[model samples]
Target chain A: MIGSRQHGGGVIAFTFIIALLLTVIPLPEGLRFLRPDWVGLVLIYWCMALPHRVGVASGWFMGLMVDLLTGTLLGQHALSLTVIAYITLKFHQRLRLVPVWQQSLTVLVLLVLHQLLALWISRIIGRPGVPWYFWMPSVLGMIIWPLVYVTLRGLRRGFRVS
Target chain B: MLVSLSVVLMVMDHRFKSLESVRNTLSLLVYPIQLIVEIPGTVTDWLDESLATRRKLQEEVDSLRTQQFMQQAQMQKFAALQAENIRLRELLDSSFEIGEKVLIAELMSVNLDPYKHQVVINKGELHNVYAGQPLVDADGVMGQIVHAGPYSSTAMLITDTSHAIPVQVNRNGLRTIALGSGTINRLELPYIPNSADIQPGDLLITSGLGGRFPQGYPVATVSAVQHDPGNAFASVVATPLAHLNRSREVLLIWPGHTTDINSVVSAPVEASAEKADTEAAPENGEAADNHSTAADTATATP
Candidate 1:
């Protein structure tokens, strides 16, 4: 039964790679608002879909890679990402039942919280003040949440839910 | 297992600096992946650009043409200024260190996390880009590469909070360290006395005091200087001279000397350009061969 329902690891890893690519590729000036936090969006998708397989622990690991690549203080992204994963896992059942539009709104709030938490940690560690572009990915993440959710749900349904 | 891996990465990232080597290998492998990944976005951008109407396209073309013309005019002025600079370096018998043979590297990928300000470029150990090599645009110094990979490396821009550079006042050559206040387009030159002879418009070029950046490249210009009686030190605000966020191209300047070159050039190079420009990079590299030659021709700060 698990085999019937479970998505292949290759698909998941491929999606992860795509998410990494999305994070790096620059968005155009006009459509930058549509540029989601690719890493978080994918993590949210995977968390809601396969909470047992990947959760806070996995999120923390990936967040470490992001922090390393971005040259931030170690453990900064790990804390926030772990928090995000826990929050998503906590409400995932209800979130899965919610309509697509509301699901996106919920993800928006999570992303905003994630960003604010990172900012708070940054401040505590001696960095002060950030540009408005720092928050752009959150709003963009919200906008793209539906697309990510729908696409993954489609993959899930095409293979198993039916 | 996951937590342990993260702990390992965190430890490696900070304590041992072992991740830098892995990062280099991984980035070199990821280089082609980056190209493949960037293609769709590039195509989408091109398609959107081509979709513009004729009038809008014409307007864009005209504006671009005007911008090009202005840059051309600026380049002419630069040429003339460079000629004068060469003559002055000749007079002072100083070295010429500048744009020629400057390494050019493309931005490979920008770090994705919003909290950190950093970028990785396509240059690396093979290309002579190393940790602490100064990254600059045509205008001024931007940042320094912190982690050098085989084919790519991470550069911490001057706007990043952790990065700082040594700068000198172009007017009188007063030295100070400029700290990045964690914001692009802003840097802080802190700890100067309210009485320091720094004007609002003073240019801050590299002092070469840090043995990191080359001498004479522009760093920042004092945008606003406030000498507060309330605070012990002067509040000097400066904007970085480089338009880094907008620039996709950069030059990596390898200061040819390990010892502070200026801790010599404080002499007549300030008085003349020809003395400075000719003795720039090569002397810094090969001068280790003939130590007395360099010490004699250029004033040995001994």
Candidate 2:
């Protein structure tokens, strides 16, 4: 709790809300599949950065918001985010110690796992997959990970948040 | 625990429609987020419209004036035909059909999943939109509203796998069902017999058999018809006339109660004709059957 002591709940909430908004912003048709899972990425960052403050419940709540926005089967995103948050929290100390590039690799794997879980649920509910490109967001998330990580780290330092 | 709760919700929503109110309440929270996200696009569209060159605007106005004049002339003939139709029905002691009412709605967002052909529209219960209201664009029938919230509603396009529309061939009046093929731009007439009069270029319009959609809107044009000697049912596919992926605006139709429309519309004329028609009961019976069939076609969903 000492490391995250200065991080107000308000800042955490602001980040999550912004991330949710980013997820809903309309993208061009051709680039739709490549739209990164903003909520998933933000949840991962928070769970890894402040494991004690943000964990399974936060992920579950944000996942529900995504479901409401996209009108997918309710609880679909919640289930995936819960599992990812659990995994991230369990490995938070080790994940925090990794180099940025290595962390991106790990984040890529987590995102792919998140998508695979979502894909499996959609398949159960009988939604046909579009194409191989549907998984491209995991790759894009990996590419953007370093930038997000550095910016958030800078924000934390500047605000003296933890 | 949360996972199981969500599963329960999904099953309940799919099977019983118990979560409709829940979804609507949650959508009230979602409405603002949608508006905020749409602001940028709206501003860009506004800028384009306002910043257009005066010459381009003049040309557009001139062309639109000519088009309006032509359409108004055509509409005058249509109105006369409708009045004549009602008068003829009055003479025959049959019912009259009422014209449908429409509300203009703009598309807010398309569902991100390509598998689900659904869009959110700006109109909802506030505008008297309801579930099963048919939607159309400039070209033809687009889809129907599946969920109506307070300020917004969701429409499932004609291309969804679960959607089916009753259609008749314009060339021969052969009736069939056009089932959404889970692909945009195409619908399948799976059960049409090989001997059916359908061809590659035939036009399919709503037969008004389905109680959901009103009669006579163009649904699709037959794009391909493959008949095999060994197969009983021909493989027929048609392209939707509406710009399903492109249209930003849609017309929501209120198909007013069709049953007593004839008596309601011809009340004044009915006074004189009713007395005379009473003398010819057999003619009235035949005319009533024809009128009822027309009424049934407008309301019948199946």
Candidate 3:
């Protein structure tokens, strides 16, 4: 049982690393707004699947990584991701009971909340206002939710993460 | 608890600016992930290089040789001009020297935050790259390094909304500040007066007023100038001469360091060729001359 728990921890870490990689990978100028919030999606998935293991602290850690990698205000992404993890943990029981499509709707709200918090921080720090397209990533993250959900679910069952 | 901790971090970072050491330490842990993401790009570049045919390679070499010959010819005239300028400066009893040491750094292909015009370069404190060091491409000034990590650094492109550079008109030497307009292609000159002798197609070069950037490097070309009677200042727009989106390599310059004229004159051609060899040697040639220029537009405008 201890060995299985260790394996599950490794799997979770590997997935987070992959998500971090996808978060910063370069996309074309036109398609940049369409780049999904891969880290946020993965964090939401983990928080919903194993609330005890992946909660606010994991979200905060990943967010700090995003901030360092992206060169934003040090705590900007940390705050957003912590809030996201908290919300996901709060609703994980109800969210897991629903179908994947309905779970995606919840994911959409979480992603939007994440973006809004980030935007608010940017404003407070005197950054210029973004245009309408700045919110496109949340919408794109919503669309990509089902795919991330199924793949992560398969990996979780295979690894027996719980 | 995590939220409050993050909020405290944000306040420290944005308001007090005291968390640089902490950020750098965290960046060290995050560097491996950055390297992993960069592998696919490096692999594609290698594949492209290895797959090139001999004829294609020969053609590239021939073209490069022809370009080098042309540049060498121009360097002769530049050498003569430099001697004359030095002689004139000496006659005027001035001690301003023009040469600076340059190190080539490749832009890591990570696009961080579309809203923030930041690019990562594979040079850092280990390479003697400091915060606020000027970055330039072959064509013109690119930007300045904002955060210097141990193995990599973050640069704010001149097109970022929060960035501004001191510039002067090449034709008449009318000085002004070029502010980034949050777009890649454009820079805004908000301080130019309606009656200022600036026009479309006038070349803007670094005036060296701020002590942050070296003097006389091309910054942008004035693309449009419009006078609004309602406003006191002219709405001047310039297109940055540096290929901000396209250029893969840039030079980190150490201003006031007197390196060999060959490196300075042939910077465009040699930047890519000698990048691998010069990556290790941190050339601390001389102290930077920080004498402020006559106009202080950088502080006034921004």
Candidate No. with top lDDT: 3
Predictions ranked by DockQ, top down?
Answer: 3, 2, 1
iRMSD of prediction 2: 2.1
Candidate 3 backbone collisions, by pair: none
Model 1 misplaced stretches (Cα beyond 4 Å):
A1-7, A28-35, A52-61, A73-79, A86-95, A98-113, A129-144, A159-162, B1-8, B28-33, B40-101, B109-111, B257-302
Per-prediction DockQ scores?
Answer: 0.25, 0.42, 0.84
lDDT of 3 by residue, B1-302 (tens): 98999999999987664687788778998899889878889999999999999999999999999999999999888887876775665555543346678899999988798888989999989999988888999999999998899999999899998888878899987777788999999999998778889999999998666567877899999999999989999999999999998899999998756577734433222112212212322121011111123232122111
- Binned by DockQ into CAPRI classes (incorrect, acceptable, medium, high), candidate 1 is acceptable
TM-score between model 2 and native:
0.86
Q: lDDT tens digits, residues A1-162, model 3?
A: 676556689889999999988888888899877788999999999999999789999999999999998999998899999999998999899999999889888899999999999999999878898889888888888888999999999999998888
Best by TM-score: 3
lDDT of 2 by residue, B1-302 (tens): 76677678767766666787787778787677777777887999999999999999999999999999999999777766877877886678754345567778999863444457888899988888887788999999999887788998888888887777777798977777788888888998887888878899899987555456676789999999999989999999999999999999899987654343334444434223123223333332223221133233323311
Candidate 2 overall lDDT versus native: 0.77
Mind giving the per-residue lDDT tens digits that candidate 1 earns over A15-92? Answer: 766776766666554454345667788888889888887789778866765565555656666767887898899998
Please provide, for model 1 over B112-190, each residue's C-alpha lDDT reduced to its tens digit, 9 standing for 90 to 100.
4444467778787998777877789979998888878776777878877667676778998776778887667898988
Predicted chain B of candidate 1, TM-score versus the true chain B: 0.68
Kept native contacts, as fractions per model, are 0.29, 0.39, 0.89
